[model samples]
Target: MYSSLLMILGALVVGYMIPVKHPSALLTIRRLSSWMLYLILFLMGYGLAFIDNLSQNIIQLFSQSAVLVSLLLTFNLSALYFVGRYLAMPAAEPIHKKAITSLRCLKNLRCLSRC
Candidate 1:
């Protein structure tokens, strides 16, 4: 467990230290990381399937997970509701409907003509 934690932390530190300048490289890394996450989740489910009395324990797990999820949702929603209510945030226009700034419009027109 400690070794796993250390390796994960080391990789995280290395990731921060390395500079990825290319957009394509960043997209490739993101795709690979997502695949790795999916694989890990698949393997965990596979391992769980082989555990003894999992059928019996599954009910308990479901109930516990349901309760946990409900509590998390309730608390998060209530907090967000209270925050939104207390904070007098103005309703803003939708992004697509909002007027483009003169600088941005110039940049867009230049790019369209040149590129």
Candidate 2:
């Protein structure tokens, strides 16, 4: 575990040395990284196919996934609602008025799961 943490920290230090000099190149890299991340995740799912008890646990796996999805959806909607309510209050900070931020966050999550 410590080795993995040290490796990640080293990678982070190396990553900071690379410069995003152009907006277009930065945007391209961001899009490419997102796609690559999805590819990595899809590849990871292949391990699930080889599980010894997959046939028996398929339903349990799906049920747990459904439960997790419901919990996340509930939290997202609740946050959007409360944030909207907070924005309506007179004392709300100008920063809080970045209201579409929650929607964008949800969109990013949905893209990861669906795209």
TM-score of each: 0.58, 0.51
Top candidate by TM-score: 1
Model 2 clashing residue pairs (backbone) = none
Q: Tens digits of per-residue lDDT for model 2 on 18-86?
A: 987999998998898789779857866987778888889999989999999999999999999999887
lDDT of 1 by residue, 1-115 (tens): 5987798789989999999999999999999989988997898789888989998999998999999999999999999999989985899867876555766767788645433
Q: Tell me, by lDDT, which candidate is best.
A: 1
> Each candidate's lDDT (Cα)?
0.87, 0.80
Question: Model 2: residues >4 Å from true position, as ranges?
Answer: 1-21, 89-115
Model 2 deviation from the true structure expressed as Cα RMSD, one decimal place: 17.0
